[model samples]
Structures are given as structure tokens and as C-alpha cells.
Target: MVQVIDGDTMVVMKGEESVNVRLYGIDCPEGNQASGREAWIFASKLADGNPVEVQPIDIDRYGRTVATVHVNGRSINEELIRSGHAWVYTQYCTNDFCRDWLKLQSDSQGARSGLWAAKNPTPPWDFRHSFKLAQATPQSSKPKAPPASAASYHGNISSRIFHDSSCQHYDCKACTATFTTRQQALDAGYRPCKKCGAK
Candidate 1:
């Protein structure tokens, strides 16, 4: 059985188990974004209960199997682009064939179909980034006291990395663990996060 989660996400049943798949190389709008519902409807028709072949690309931090999905030997990824349901996610799309997906997106944008019907469609990546920034932004305009540690360091157990409290990533969701000093993080086998100037 194939189940549709959203425009670019789905689950395929294998007897007693199932696999969660995220379509690779393309990014669709969020569930609440403009034309988001339309994209889901299109994707549901393409993959719902239909046989598909997934080419595993990478496992994201969220543990989603990112891959290109083919339904009835047709590239669902390409179809989404050709119909303006998604944009080429160039950040992680370094493969040679990604160029074709980009071209398809360009054509779709020119035609202003589906999500492209909007004069300026906001990419889902940008939307998520803005949302995260909003969520991570402190609610009060006034500043709060920093971690009572002598030294200023923020640690994330999941990534096993530490960031300078002055760094923008310091108060990220994963960075619940605080460190008094850089040495304290190093002693705990936590390295510095590259995003921040943790050297």
C-alpha cells in the first residue's frame, strides 16, 4: 500500500512494515502555504496506492529516506516540476540530472501553472527558514540572563557539537545542553558547530 502524507512525502507498505519516503531534488510548498492543498492532491493522484520505485539518495537528519520516486516508470519528481507543483531544491540537488529538473521548473514557472499561478511564489525552504527564525527568536524584546556558566557555550546532544553562546545557533532547539566553557564541551567529546565561529 502507498499512502500520501503531503505533496512530496509518502509511505509505502511492505507487508508488516513501511518506509517513509521524501521525494528528492524537489521542494513543494508547505501544507499551509498557497496552493499547498493543490500540490497534495496532484501528488496523491500520482502515488496513492500506485506502485512506485524509490532511488535512495540520502537520509536526512529527520530520518526521512530522501529519494527520487518513479510511478509506473514515470518520474514523479519530474511530473511535480513540469506541473509547477514544486521547485528544484538546489541546495542538496548536486546530481547531473538535477539540471533537467531545474529546466522543468523554469518551464513551469514560465507557464504559471499550479503553485506558480502566484505572481511570486515563496519557496518552501525560505518559508521554513523564516518560520524557524521566528520560532527561535526570543519572545520578549528585553534580553534574558545567559546561562549562569562562567564561560559561554551552547551544546546540542543530538549533533554532539557546541556553539559559542554569542553564535546565532546557540539557542537552537537541539541546544538544550549548556556548557560553561569550550573545554567543557571538548571534554564531553562535543566538537564545535561549523555554522558558528566555533574554532
Candidate 2:
């Protein structure tokens, strides 16, 4: 049996030990990124509580087994690409098998399926690289100042997401609608954003 950790990672019970496996030749979006939760949900539906056969390729630097997984003869990695939930990891995929995987991604893109539905979707690798670089760079060497008290809720007319004044997305150029209270935002037909948990 297998338990999905995310779109591209899983934990499998091997004998008495649990083994961490990273799906080979595919990279999914990060957890906090756009469509990241959707990818995870799709992957969970495919893998959770299901019996999967893993073909180990190598071990990653993080000690996760890099492998190809099959669930009832369907290649999970290929399926992810075909379904537009993941990208074929060209940098790490050097084998001849990658050609077919790349083709699958192209087909999905042409059909505008899944992540391809977005006009421009950021790849997980690029997102991770940018995140790492931001972590390494400091905004200021001086001591950080405490944030002010959060104000009442506000809503973005375009996005239909509501948050308090201190929320990251609050009061942006698109957030034209103002609410005196959280309930007012809800009454205005705005939902809480997952990032700030407005409700």
C-alpha cells in the first residue's frame, strides 16, 4: 500500500519499514503555490491506500528513493504529465524514456489540460530555485519591526478573496471593495483566501 505525501512524493510500507519515494522524471508544483493543492488532491486520489509497484532508479540527495511507480500497470509519472499535474523533469531525466514523457506533456499542453489551463504556469523547479535564492538574500540586516494590529476585512473585486488589512493580499490594487467587518465581506459574496485564512 502507498500513502501520498504530495503530488510527487509518497511513503510506501516495505516490510516493517516505511520508505520515502520521489516519483522519477516528474516535478509537481510546491505546496504553497497556485494549483499545488489541486495537484496533491489529484495525486492522493490516484495513490492513497492503493497498491503500487515501485521500480527504484536511484537515491536522491535527500535520501528519498527516486523511482518509477505503477498502479495496476498505469505509470503514475506518465499519467501526471498527461493529466497536466506535473512536468517532465528534463534536467534529471537523461534516459530514453524521457522522450515519451516529454511527448505526453506536449500533448497535454496542446489540449490545454490541467496545469496547462493556465496561460503561464511556473514550474516547481523554478519556484524552488527562486524560493532558495530569496531565503539566502536578506531584506535588511537591521532588527525586524513588529507588524501593526490587523484592521477589518477587505475584498478584492477581481479575485473574490477577502482578508484583513494586514493580510498579504489585502488592499492591493485589485482589492477595491472595503468591508467594515468580516461578516460584511462574507455578505458581499467574498470567500476567505487560503493564504490568510480571512474567516
Candidate 3:
């Protein structure tokens, strides 16, 4: 692998191309979330710069290659769950192995491993949703723009994603729609910018 982006995401050298791979059937905490750094360190030690096997599963909405990765004949995806560094992503895990993975997750939770050490740790999906809700607060009751350049929220019409000023893509080529508040973008059916975690 060329780089371990996080606990469950990596950039691997697939032939001459660098492919972004999302580990299948499991979800790890985001880098900024609880137990996130520990999970990342463990995954990096297990997989980074190692010649590993990638078992292709499916492509995700973000265009990432979803796969099960193996290092030294051991499955990294399964290892993460076994170590309590990840949770079984039941929403997308349709394969038969998901049942076994869920059992492992339960065992980890019962043992208070990793993020489960917290009495009630927030799931990554729920964390993301809460973050969006927090950011969705309207700047003002009425919608009005001071100026085009001063707009706080920017939307990419093509991708249907909105970015805040903090994002590098806030003023990207496709970001023609401008909003005074994040709620305006959300009301228009635009999803938050994943990179900046903008709502």
C-alpha cells in the first residue's frame, strides 16, 4: 500500500495507478473522532508499505474501490474488527461473512475494547449526522447575500455537494451556487462537503 488514509481507507498502488480503497464490511472512526488515532496507528503498522492482496468487492458512491485487504495471508478488515478498531458496517455488508463480523463486533463491544471503552460511544455515521445538524444552523432568519465573494456556503451543482469557506473546494469550478448559510444548501438537496465536513 502507498498510504493508509485512516483505519479503514488506504491508497494502494494498483499496477501503475494509485487506487483509493475503502475496506469492505467494516467502518472505522473518523480521524478526528474518539479512538480514531489508535485505530489508524494499528492499521498503518499492519498494512502500510506492505505488499498485500486486495479482494475487490464494489465501488462506492465516492468512487472508492471497496475491497477486503490481506497482509501476510491475514485479512486486515477482519483484524480491525477483532481488535475493536472498527465496527461492522451492516448497511452495506451483504456478504455471508457479515454474520461472523457482527459476532466479532459484539465480542469487542462486550469486552469494552477500543471505542467501546466509552459507555456509549457515538457511531461514525451518527457523528457525521450530528455534525451536519450542528452546522445546519441558519446564519439569519431571512436568506440574503451580502456579496458573491462573501458567501459562506458554496455548492457544486454537478456533484450536488456544498462546501463551507474552510474547504479548499469552496470556490471550485463547479461551485456556482452560493448560499448565505449551510441550511440553504441542505434545503437545495446538496450534501455536505466530505473533505471539510461542511454541512
Candidate 4:
């Protein structure tokens, strides 16, 4: 029997070996290293320290069993999202409820609740990659810039065919007025210039 731990990792009591089970179809915030404590608290409440059935769908490279846990005949994964504690792992989720989970996450983000309260929260997978990179490299190192040729030009200015700076992607000649900031123009409901569209 394994007890649900967090969104991703779990603890299974298997005789002497304590198996760490990783749940599928959900990517909870990192509990230990990055908001891991909060994640753990959320997961514990969801699991309530009870024994859960670990239905394995696959085994991850780390030998952790990837499973969809069911407790009291309810989908723990769905509960996590509905409670605004976890997000659907879009990269790996195959369940039909994935769309619903995504919607739940969107709603939470719009409401600025739970994990969404963090400013510019990174996805768990991306956070792991960045953590590894930081551990392997020095922070003082500067990143290389892209080549100048990689830059793209809009178009040649002529015959009053200029892109509205407000809407760079739209070439609207009717609204050629450029504002100091794009937000200002967008607030006025002005579309891109018809002649030269800017994005």
C-alpha cells in the first residue's frame, strides 16, 4: 500500500523497500526544493495519510512507478486540480479529464489562487531543467546573443503604408496613430494599421 505524498511523488510501503511512486497526469509544484513544502501540505490534505490504490500505467526512467491513484473510488488527480493544488501534466496525461483539469488551472490562474499566487511560476519540468543547469554552471556566466541576421524587418516605408506601432502585426492605414506605448493604443480599441501590420 502506498500513501499519496505530493502531486508527483508518493511513498509506497513494499516490505523493506520503500517505493517512491510518481503520479501520472499531474504536475504538482516542486515540494522540497521549490515550494515543495506547500506542495506537500496540499498533497497530504488530499491523501489524508490513507493507503491509496496505485494503478500503474507506466514506469518512469527513475524506476518510480507512474500511476493514477484512486482513493475511496475517487480520482485523486482530478481532486488535486479541482482543489487548485495541481495542474494537469499536458505533456503526458492521457485521461479524458485532462481538458477539464486544464480549464481548472486556467480558472485558478485567472483568480490568482493557490499556486498561481506566485509571480511568474515556472512549470515543474522547466524548473527541474533550470535547476540542473544552475547546478552545472556558474551564475556569473553571460548568455550568448542571437546573430544580428536573425532579426526580421517589417517592410519598406512608402506611400503612407506604415504599420501602426500600437498593433505591430496589423497593417491598418486607418489607424496610423502611434502611441508611446502599445498598451495605450490597445486600451483605445485601435486595430493595427491596414497598410503595414505589426505584431
Candidate 5:
């Protein structure tokens, strides 16, 4: 693997190409969410610099490859759940193997491991939904400065999405394009990030 981007995403070399793989059946905390750093550290320890096996499952809306990664025959997706670093992501975990992962999640929760240690840990999906809502809310009516000259926005050429600096995905590998303002990105046919409210 080239590097571990977050708790559940990593860049792996496929021939001469680098593919972004989102671990299947699990959802980790976002970079700004609770236990997010710890989850990334754990995943980094397990996968970074280690050769892994990727079993492709599907392609996500963001153009990420959803797959189960294995290291030394151990499933990293399952390990994340067992270690309490991620949730079962039941929305897409329809296979029978998900049952075992669900059990692991329950056990982790019962043990109060990792993020489960929180009094009421927020799921990543719920946190993302809240972020989206907060982003949608109107801002101050005060006059804002004109669009800055510096390129402060990152655009994902493939996904056609743009993200500001505040976004965890602002430096995503696919975000090779840059824009001086949100309007520039919009005019260039890019949309705001759903996670960070880049608009």
C-alpha cells in the first residue's frame, strides 16, 4: 500500500496506478469526529507499508473502490470492527459475513472499546448528516470579502466535487485540481462536498 489515508481508506498500487480503496462493510470516524485520529493510527499500524490483498466489491458514488483488504490473511475490515475503530455500516453490509462483524461490533460496544468508551458515541454517518445540516444553514448576513486569489479549493476531477480547506478530504489524492473560489469550482462543473459543506 502507498499510504493509509484514514481509518477506512488507503491508496494501493495496482500496476502503475494508485487506487483508493475504501474498506468494505465498515465506517470509521471522520477526521474531525471522535476517535478519528486513533482509528487512523490503528489502521496505519496495520496496513501502511504492508502488502495487502484487495477484493473489490463495488464502486462508490465518490469513485472510490469499495473492497475488503487482507493482510497476512487477516481481514482489515473485520479487524477494525473487532478493535472498535469502525461500525458495521449495515446499509451496505448485506452479505452473511456481516453477521459476524455485527457480533464483533456488539462485543466491542459492550467492552467499551475505542470510541465505544464514549458515553454516547456518535456514529460516523450521523455525524456526517449533522455536518451536512450545519453546512446547509444560512450564514451571517454581514458582507463577505471578495473571492480570494489563492487557490483555496480542491477539486476532484473524477467525482467533480470541490472541497475547501476545512474538509478532511481537501487533500484527497484525487483532488488534483484547484480553484480560487467556490464559484470558480461551480462554474467549472464541480459540486460542493457533502461531508464538509464546501460551498
Candidate 6:
């Protein structure tokens, strides 16, 4: 079971037969990135081409076993994420590791390790769609950039921005004006300034 096929998939030998197992509760990036390959390497090292204790929860539509794999008393799913090899997948997670996995992802992201190295790395699911679309259509026109002056201040129209800094990007989109400070932007009913990358 030590050979990694991809970020989230592995091949394990079960009673002399090979079985494909999709790791549960976590999502690694696609194979196109360095982080994706790192994830595969980490999983392979954890599995060590040996029989692991796989507790299958269900069979996914792709017929792969969706399971929590344990090797040497450690949960491979958690190890992959905590070690910065993978990300916790909230959309399809079925285990208690979901929250912990998310925390691990956050920690990795904060450290700018693996996938976090990219300025904006695409999620695996989203990357899949983008890949399909790319295959269907050849690269052509460049996307048009938004106008710098296309912005408006919110004033009293929106008060919620004052409390939540996350709304900055949305406010920047609506106002078309970037702000120097989050507080100033929020006071103007413009959320955080996206152009300045206020976050």
C-alpha cells in the first residue's frame, strides 16, 4: 500500500490483490504542482509498501475505498495534513479529523509551505474543472482588466463593513477604489482594500 498514485490516491495490496484507496477527510493538491508531488511522497513513505489497517467508511462513486488508513498506529490522513502534505477537505469529510485537518491546513498556509507557496493556488476540485475547460478550449484572448477609477464609496449604505474586514475585497469590487487602511475603508462603507491586498 505504499505506492502513491496521486495526492489523494494510493495503491495498497490487500491479501495479494491490489486495491485503490482514496484517503478520507483530506484533499491534496493536484499532481501538476510541487506540493502535490510532495503529498504523494509523504503518503508513500507513510504507507511504506506494507499492509495498513484500512477502515473503509464507504465506496466512492469511482469505486475507490474511502477510508481512514492507519500505519504504525498513526492515522495517515491526519499525518498527511499535519505534516503539511495535504489539506482537510470540508466538502466530503466524514470524520472528526475535519476540524483538525482544517487547522493543519491553516498552519501550513501561514507557514507558506507546499501549496501555500503559490500566491493563489487553485483547489484540487476547482483545478479539475479548469483543467477540463483548458482541454476543451485553446488559450486565446487575455482577460480584460478592470478600470482603476470604477469605484464608489458606500457611506451609510453599508454598516456591516465596519465590523468585518473580510468584506474588503467585495467593497473594493463595488467601490472601484482601493483604501490605504482597513478602518478607513470600512468607515467609508468600503470594505477592505483589495488593490493593497489588505486581506
Of the candidates shown, which would achieve the greatest TM-score relative to the real structure? 5
TM-score of 3: 0.72
| lDDT (Cα, 0-100) at 71 in candidate 4 | 75
User: What TM-score does prediction 6 earn?
Assistant: 0.64
How much does each candidate deviate from the true structure in C-alpha RMSD?
12.1, 11.9, 9.1, 20.9, 7.8, 18.5
Arrange candidates by lDDT, descending: 5, 3, 2, 1, 6, 4
**Cα misplacement distance, residue 23 of candidate 4 (Å):** 0.8
Worst 10 residues of 1 by lDDT: 143-152
Q: Rate the local accuracy (lDDT) of all candidates.
A: 0.75, 0.75, 0.77, 0.57, 0.80, 0.61
Q: Tell me how far the alpha carbon of residue 142 in candidate 6 is from the true structure, in angstroms, after superposition.
A: 20
TM-scores for candidates 1 onward, in order: 0.68, 0.70, 0.72, 0.60, 0.74, 0.64
Model 6: runs farther than 4 Å from truth? Answer: 138-199
Write one digit per residue (lDDT tens) for candidate 1, span 21-41. Answer: 788988888654676667777
Q: Across residues 73-142, which tens digit of lDDT does each residue of candidate 4 receive? A: 8777766666666778888987786787788878888887767777887777786587447546754756
Per-residue lDDT over 18-107 for candidate 5, one digit per residue giving the tens place of the 0 to 100 score:
787888989998755778768877988898677899999999876789999999899999999999899999999998999999999999
Worst 10 residues of 6 by lDDT: 151-160
Against the true structure, candidate 3 has what lDDT? 0.77
RMSD of 4: 20.9
List ranges where model 4 is wrong by over 4 Å: 1-5, 14-18, 32-34, 138-199
Judge candidate 1 against the unseen true structure and give its global Cα lDDT, from 0 to 1.
0.75
> Which lDDT tens digits does candidate 6 get at residues 1-199?
4545555776577778766678898888754544665776677778775668988988776567888889888988888777777777888895665877788788888988776778887777786577447545744776344243322222112222321222433332222222333444453233433344443
lDDT of 3 by residue, 1-199 (tens): 4566568877788788777678999888765567766787788899866898999999876667899999999999999998899989999899998999999999998988888889888787786577557556676576553454343576665576888766888767656444555665675467998889774
> How does residue 57 of candidate 1 score in lDDT?
94
lDDT of 2: 0.75
| Candidate 2 C-alpha lDDT tens digits along 1-199 | 6756557876788888777788998998865466665776787788867788999999876667899998888888988899999999999998899999999999999999888999999998887688558545766675343333223565654466887644777646655344445665675457988888975
Misplaced by over 4 Å in model 2 are 141-199
